[model samples]
Target chain A: MIASTSIHIERTTTPKAKPPQDKLGFGIYFTDHMFIMNYTADEGWHQSRIVPYQPITLDPAAKVFHYGQTVFEGLKAYKTADGRVQVFRPDANMRRMNLSNDRMSMPEIPTDLVLDAIKGLTHIDQDWIPDGEGNSLYIRPFIIATEALLGVQPSQAYTFMIIMSPVGAYYPEGINPVKIFVESHYVRAMIGGVGEAKTAGNYAAGLKAQDAAKEQGYTQVLWLDGAEHKYIEEVGSMNVFFKIDGTVYTPSLNGSILDGITRNSVIQLLRHWQVPVVERQLSIEEIYEAGKNGKLEEAFGTGTAAVISPVGELNWLGVKLVINGGATGGLSEKLYNNLTGIQYGKLEDEFNWMVEVK
Target chain B: MIASTSIHIERTTTPKAKPPQDKLGFGIYFTDHMFIMNYTADEGWHQSRIVPYQPITLDPAAKVFHYGQTVFEGLKAYKTADGRVQVFRPDANMRRMNLSNDRMSMPEIPTDLVLDAIKGLTHIDQDWIPDGEGNSLYIRPFIIATEALLGVQPSQAYTFMIIMSPVGAYYPEGINPVKIFVESHYVRAMIGGVGEAKTAGNYAAGLKAQDAAKEQGYTQVLWLDGAEHKYIEEVGSMNVFFKIDGTVYTPSLNGSILDGITRNSVIQLLRHWQVPVVERQLSIEEIYEAGKNGKLEEAFGTGTAAVISPVGELNWLGVKLVINGGATGGLSEKLYNNLTGIQYGKLEDEFNWMVEVK
Candidate 1:
C-alpha cells in the first residue's frame, strides 16, 4: 500500500478565474487541478498524483469506449461555520466504488489512498467550494479501462480520476415537491444484471425513460422490476421512499437495486427518531392502493446531488396519485432540514457523519 | 444530410510499420488513417474527415466516460482472389447502428456518408488487408457522447469515428467444435432494455459470466433470457442455431437479443438452398430433450468475428449434452464453407451482398 505522503503534486501554472457562486450550475465548471492514478496488471495501483485539470488523451480502441467497463462515485464537501472543510460519508462512497468495480470486473482501489486523494485535492481547491446555502463542492471520482484492446475480457490497464465542480442547489426554487412518472414499459435493470453497480451503462439505459417522462410533464421516473413491473426499484437514479400509515418504506437491496448512502442514512435517522422505517419489496400497486385509501402520506428520493427530493405526485398508467396535497409533508421537511443541516455543519454532528479534512 | 464528397482527407506523415499477416490478431493493430465526424444539436453530424490515427482528447467529465452514451457497429473488408477489396453487408451494419443510436438517444448518422467513409478509408488503407486465408481487415465504427457535463441526460455533442484493424481467423486451429456453458445466473438484457442495440453496456454485462465459464473449462457462455432462465438468448455475444430433425431452429427476434447480420445472412442462405429453417423460441430443456431423443443434429453460433462457430458439447447444470459425438457436424461445416466462399469472392454473389470498393 502506498502512503499518502508518496502522492506527487503538480500545481497548474495558469489558473482560470472561478465562477460566481450564483452562476455555478451543477457540473458546468471544474476546478484548476484534479486527481489521477494509474493501475496495471503488473504494477497493481500506483503512481498517484494531483495534476492540472486538462483533457485526457486515449487511443480510439480503449475498452471503456467500446465495452462500458467503468465505475464512479459522487459526494460533496462543505465549508462549516468555523471555516473548515468537511466531507459527508466519503468512506462510504469509496467502498461503494470498489463494490461497483468488483461487479464490472475492474481492479479495486485502496480506500485509504482514495480518501487521502479526495481530502488532499479538496484542501488544495478549497476556494472553489460555494458558500451559499444548499451549495457545496460536488466531487466525482471515476475509473475507466484504459487498455487499447477490443476483446470482451477485462482490461489490463485502468485510470482513476477525480474532478470537482462547485454548484448551486439542485432545487434552485427551494425544496419544492416534484411529480414523478411511474414507468412500466421501460425496464431500468434486471434482478441478475449490473443495475446494482454504479456503472455507466446503467445510467445510459435510463436516458430514454427519463426523456419520455420529461416529455409527459413529469420531473422524474420511478422504475419498476424488469420481471413483474410491479415492485418499486428507484426514482430517477435515486433511492425512493414512500410514507404509508406514518411509516417509511424503501425497496430492499435485491441485487438489481443500488445500495445508496443517503438512503441508508435516511433509514438510520428515521429509526433514531423512532419513526418506523422498513426496507423490503414494496410494490407499486400497494402504494397506489394506499394512496387511494388515504394511507399514503409522503414520498421522496434520496441521492448525493439532491439530499432529499420530495415527490409531490406520481402518475401510474394514466392515474395521478397526489401526495400531501402536492406539498412537502412535515416529516419530509424535517428530514431534509436535519440531513442538510448536518451536512453543512449547521447542526451538531450527533452521528459523526462529517469527516474533517484537516 | 452531408454529402460524401464533403469529407476532407489528411494523410499521415509518419507511417507505422505494418505487422506480419501471421501476427494479425483481432482489433490489436490499427491502420494509418481513420474517419471521424462530429455531431451537435445545431450542426447535425457535419464536418466529416479522414485524418491520421492518433489519441483522442476528452475532458474528464465527458458524458461517454460517465453515462456510457455510445453505440458501435462491426464489419470486415476482404481481399478477393482477383485482388479487389469488398465489404460484406456494410449497409446492414449502418442501419443497425442507427437503430442503436435511436435507442441510446443519440443522433442518427447518414448511411450514405457512412458507407462512403468505410469504402474511402478501406481504399486508402487497402495495403493493410492481409492475404492469408480467413484473414481480413476489420472495421469498427462507433459514436460517443462528447459533451463534458456531469448531468445524466443525452449529450449535445457527439464524435463518430471509424477505425480499421487487420484480423486473423477467429478459430486459429481450424473450424473445430467448442464447448459452451449454459449460464443461468447472470442476465444480459431485459425485454424492455437496450439488448437489441449494439451498445457497450450489454458487452460489459457478459464479461463476468464469460470469465466464470472460462474458469470452468468452457469456451464461451450461452446466455438465458432475463425474465426466466429457460429460453436461449445468445451464445457468447453471437446468435445461436440448432439443427434438430433436419431442420434449423434459432431464437426469434426478441427485444432482448441482438439482430446479427451474419445470423440473418445464414438464414437467407439456408432458405435460398431450400433448406428448412425456422425462427422461434427454443429453450434449453427442449435442446436437452432433443439430444437425449437422438434428434439434435448440429449446433453453431454466427457473428461477424466468427462466421460460424460449431458447438459440439453443452454443459447445462452439470449435465454434459454432447452432440454429433462431440465433433463438427456436416451441416455446420457446409454453412461455414459456403459463407466464407461468398465472403472471399470464391462463389457467385447471387444475393448481391458484397459491395466492392473501386
Candidate 2:
C-alpha cells in the first residue's frame, strides 16, 4: 500500500491551452493533471499518483455503475490579490467526506492523505485558476466502488480521485435573486436514507423535480420534508436560510439535510455579528403566511457553488410569494459580500477559515 | 440512430470456457457476448449492437460516477427440461426499468427494443445456460448517464447495456428457512423518494444496514418505512410476504416498496388457488403480536434472485420470534415448488408469464 508521505507524481508531456477566463463555466474545462488512489480489500489504498487527466476503464459489472456506490466533495481554490493561492475550509470538506463515507458504507480516506493530494494537485495546476472576477478552480474529490461484481453489498475494491475545473461565477448577471418552485410531488431524501451523505443517489433523486421546475420557468426547486412534505428541507443544492420578523432562521440538521461547510460558516458569522440567527424547522406554510402578513424579510441559500443565492419569488401550488419585491435582501447581499471577500483574502479572516495552498 | 430492428452483432473471435455447472454461483461468471446501446440528446438511442463482453472506458467526470444517474433490472433466462430457453415476465421488468428511468429524469427506451435485446442476447448465449439444479443465466440490463459533466442535473448522454451471468440456486442447502433481523435504525427509502424505482441509490442506501445485519448473524435485514419506522417495507432486496391466521398478506404498493414481479406473480397464483390474500400496510408491532399469539403461520421474501426465501426467525429489538419452529412453512415450500416448477416448464403456466426465447 502506498503511504501518505510517498505519493508518486507523473507529469504530462503535453499540456493543453487553458480556456479564456470569461469562458470558464462550471465543470466544463479540466486541468491537465489529476490525483488518484486505488483501494482493495487486501491491500487497502495504494498506488497514489498524480497523472494527466484521462479516461478510466472498468469492468462492465463494476458496482458503482449499477449500485451507485459513490460519494463526492466540491470546493474551490481561490487566487488572491497578492498572487497567492488558497482554499476555503478544505479540512472541513475532507472531514465531511469521511462522514459521508461512513454513511455510505465505504472506507474513509486518511485526512492527511486527502489534504496532501488536494494541496499537491492545486499547486501543480495553480495556473488554471481563472483571473476573472468570481472565477476560481473548482476542486472535485470523489470515491467510487470499482469491484467488478453484480451484487448489493459493499464493494471489495474502490478508487479515489480528485479532478479540477476552472469555473465562472454561478450568476453572470451579478448576484441576482432567482425564482424557485416549491416541489410537492417529488422528494429528494428522507430522514433515515443517505440524504445527509454527499453521495450520488441524493443528487439523482432531485433531478426529476429540478427538471419539472425548470420547465415551469423556475431557476431551482425548494424541497420539503419527505414524510409530510410540510417542513422545508433545502433549496436546490444548498442549505437555505429565511429571515422573518427580524430574526434569521435556517433548517436544523435533522439528519436529512447536508451539513454544508458554508452553512456552518454562515451561521458562525451571523452569530458573531449578532444577527439573531436560529436553526429550527421552518415550514413552507409558515413562510407563505409570513409573506401574506409582510413579515417575510429575506431568504437565501448557502453553498460552495453560489456562496449566497438570493430568493426572488417562490411559487407554491400557484400561490406566488414575492419577498423583498422580488429583489435581493440587505442581509443576503451583506453575507455574499463578506463571504466572497473572505474567500478572496480581502476581508479579515476572523474565524480563520482560509488555508493557503502553498 | 439505430432502431429496434436494426441491432447489429459482432461475434467474438475466441469464445470463453464456460464455468462448471456445479461451481457457478450468482453474478460471478459472465457470458461471452453482451448487448449495448447509446443515447444522446441529439440522437436519442443509437448504435445498438451485441459485442464481446469487455471493460467499458469512461471519462472520470461521467455523470454516473458523480451523481448516480443509473438504473438496472435483474431477470433470469432458464433452460427448461425440453431444452428450450425461456425468461419469465421479462416485459414486466422492462416496464419497471422505464418507470425507474422516468423517476431518475432519463429518457425511456422503447419496450420493443429492450425485449429485442434481451431475447437476442439470450439466443446468442444459449450455451452459457448452466445445466444444474435451480441454475439459470442471470440477465442484467442497466442504463447509466455517460455525459462527462460534474453538475447535479440530467445527463445529455446515456449508455444502456445488457450483461449475463450464470448462477446456481440462491441457497446451497435448498429452500430452507433463514434468520432475519428487523431493522429499526436505517431505512432503505420513504414515500415520495426513489424507493419504488429500481435505481442504484436505493440499493446503495441498504448496504450499511445489511452489513450490520450480517454481523448480527442474520441473513437479511427487514427494512421498515422511513417516516414512521413502523410499517414493514421489504426484506433485504426482495418484497416480503407474511401469513397470519389464514390470509396471505404482503405490503401494498405504497410508493415506498418496490413493485416486485415475483410478489405480483405469487399474489396471482394464490388468488387462482382460492387462497385468501390481502395487500395492505403491515406493521412490525402487529407482526409481533401475531407471533406472540401463535397466529403467524409463514413468512417469506419474493424477488428475482431468491424466488421465495422463507423466514425462520426474526430478531427485532432483542426479542427473537421463531416461526414454524425454525423450519420452512408448508405454504412457503409449496410456493417455492410451484414457482420453480412453472419456471422450469414442469407445471402449467396458467397465467402465460413465461416468454420462450427463440
Q: Quick one: best lDDT, which candidate?
A: 1
Local distance difference test, candidate 1: 0.93
Q: Which candidate comes out best when scored by TM-score?
A: 1
**Runs in model 1 with CA error above 4 Å?**
A1-5, B1-5
Q: What is the lDDT of residue A251 in candidate 2?
A: 96
Worst 10 residues of 2 chain B by lDDT: B1-10
> Per-residue lDDT tens digits of candidate 1, residues A142-212?
99999998878889999999999998888778899999999989999998899999999999999999999
Clashing pairs in 2: none
Cα lDDT tens digits for candidate 1, B89-147:
99999999999999999988999999999999999999999897899999999999999
lDDT of 2: 0.92
